[model samples]
Target: MSGPGRFISFEGIDGSGKSTQARRLAAHLEGLGHSVVLTREPGGSPGAEDIRALVLEGEPDRWSPETELLLFTAARRDHLERTIRPALEAGQIVICDRFADSTRMYQGLRRAGLRVLVDQLHDLMIGQEPDLTVLIDMDPETGLARALSRNGGEERFESFGNDLQAKMRAGFLDLAAEFPDRFVTIDGARAMDDVTADVTARVTEWLA
Candidate 1:
């Protein structure tokens, strides 16, 4: 139950249950007496939250992919500076619902050459990656259904529909393979408790 400061992130298509799992893991870690900081990207800090409204709201085409990349990068910078870095320095387990990987998949996969821009911006401004990333792998059909059921106002990305979600899922899996040292792909289609247990087990092994 005791370990060094750790930074963890959860990632997946919107309805893949990453956010719920992230919160569950944070609570589980806290139950073990570890200090935990639970947060999310695009809105972890004040500045980032402001930007989040702009980027996540409005029409799907409100911002061009290029402009969206810049906005996300800016929001990430603020979140890192104001929230993540300080918690990590203070020796707390930081559990982020989403991180740069989302930006990479969401923005990068949108168009040709954008992935390169996403990587470049991340390297230049936000030169940090989570110590561990839990990717909740789910079918696009199931995931999209879950996302739409929420009836949330932030449907900008979800509005892209099933085909894009399928591609995004593939992109996340590729990233997990590309960064095996830090990424763990979890089967998200299972029951919530089952998926949570799997995620908990993975983090426990890593911490051990």
Candidate 2:
């Protein structure tokens, strides 16, 4: 607990292979003898899990943009309080699947300028952010097609139109540009092994 923990987050569109890369990076860290905690936003805490279900499983038409943002924020707040904070304090490297960046992308869909809202909420609720964020970039069509092939059913966000998904991808790229130091852009269009190698190398460098 003496050394500060390293916090890393993986983000992208639903089908962009962020989760797959996140797991591989965590496994690599563990293999390197670092204690690692692999977690996800909106489902990391019990309260957040409930919010996650509501956001993803509730009637799609019933969910407004503000409602969606609020639910995701709620889950994030709980996740930080219950899971993220403690792990970091224990000096564990935490790899998270989806974090504030999702709000930057998805909430940007509803709000004209979502950054301010997300920041204010983070200040009021969740405090710390990841030390590094790995954002995988992929074509919306390809990622969604791959996601659909792997999934049995789609969630509200997963069911977004191609236009929305494209916008979300743009938002992610925009975020990476805006915060070059914190965001590491990885080309997810490459083969799985290649993407995994890229992600692991970044994590290894950052942790070093």
Candidate 3:
């Protein structure tokens, strides 16, 4: 990891298949002769990994939104210092799964009555924005259904009202609209291979 380069992030809810897409895209980039660093938020670093376990375990509802935001930020700062920044400095492409936008959706807006707290904490933390953020927008019901099929139990967020999840999905779309250049919205309902193909194509154009 040597010269300065680009940083990319993938954002979505539990069932959106962001991790799969991220990994596929990384491999695609590597095949094209680019050095790539694949990582994730809240646990890419050693300290972040510890926090990640706590943050994701039990239930997202177990912790308050403000507290959740703090935990995520703590992990993010460490992730940037330990993993992301180093790869970027070395001219490698860094692709992260579920970055700050997840916080904005889950902790900030999705959690009832935490919008203000989410905003304040968002500003305080998450200094570095991704050069490209791929938001895999999809229906909450379908997404949750997929998640449940893959994993047995429903977490705190999954048990939330449909309205909240819908709003979160919309929030992702709005974020993309607000940052047209930096955001790419893909059809997350599609098959994994299709989604990965679209992502790789988008990144290819961006690289050129």
Measured against the true structure, the TM-scores of the candidates, in listed sequence, are 0.97, 0.93, 0.90
Residue 15 shift from truth in candidate 1, angstroms: 0.3
Where is the poorest 10-residue window by lDDT in model 2? 151-160
For model 3, how does the per-residue alpha-carbon lDDT over 124-162 read when each residue is reduced to its tens digit?
A: 765688889998888888877776676644355676656
lDDT of 1: 0.92
Report clash pairs, candidate 3.
1-90, 2-90
Candidate 3: how large is its RMSD?
A: 2.5
Across 1-208, the per-residue lDDT of candidate 2 in tens digits comes to 2137888999998789999898999899899999999998778888998887777774557687777778888888888878888888889988999998888778766667666777788677766778899999999999878776776543677676677789889989988999999999999999999999988887788777
- TM-score of model 3 relative to the true fold? 0.90
Q: What is the lDDT of residue 22 in candidate 2?
A: 89
lDDT of 1 at 160: 91
Positional deviation of residue 83's Cα in model 1 after best superposition, in angstroms: 0.4
Displacement of residue 127 (Cα, Å) in model 2 is 2.4
Off by over 4 Å in 1: 1-4
